[model samples]
Target: MLMDDDLFSSRPEDPLASLARQDLDPLSQHELDERIAALEAEIARVRAHSEAVAKHRSAADALFKR
Candidate 1:
């Protein structure tokens, strides 16, 4: 899900925004299924990255606080 801020960001065009706006009507059921699978994989990848970044930030904050 995209926040309003993400949609209105200064970048010329975000790929995720473009992907969200893409027409899905023309896709066949198989293609839609494949697309969903790909998106799920991407979500998993992002979640892992987010967790790693949070862990790193926490470590840095702890070090700086001490």
Candidate 2:
């Protein structure tokens, strides 16, 4: 009974074994370029918005302190 439980409890297949045999889909050069450009634009927008918020917060705090 113990041996039977051990056999059942053991992982049936290795995930890495399957990964070793898998083929990855190739992305086109155009698609890769577009994705990179989109990510850069998004990062720039987020940084600008963050700076604006920090400036507003600083102004508000100075007013409150006076």
Which predicted model would earn the best lDDT? 1
Model 1 ranges off by over 4 Å: 1-12
Mind giving the per-residue lDDT tens digits that candidate 1 earns over 1-66?
999989897768778999999999999999999999999999999999999999999999999995
Q: For model 1, what is the alpha-carbon lDDT of residue 63?
A: 94
TM-score of each: 0.78, 0.58
**Cα error of candidate 2 at position 16, Å:** 26
Model 1: residue 64 alpha-carbon error in angstroms: 1.2
Query: Could you tell me the lDDT of residue 43 within candidate 1?
Result: 99
Tens-place lDDT per residue, model 2, 1-66, is 368868787667785587456554565788769867976898899999999999999999999995
Model 1 Cα shift for residue 34 (angstroms) = 0.5
Runs off by more than 4 Å, candidate 2: 1-26
Clashing pairs in 1: none
Q: What is the overall TM-score of model 2 with all chains considered together?
A: 0.58
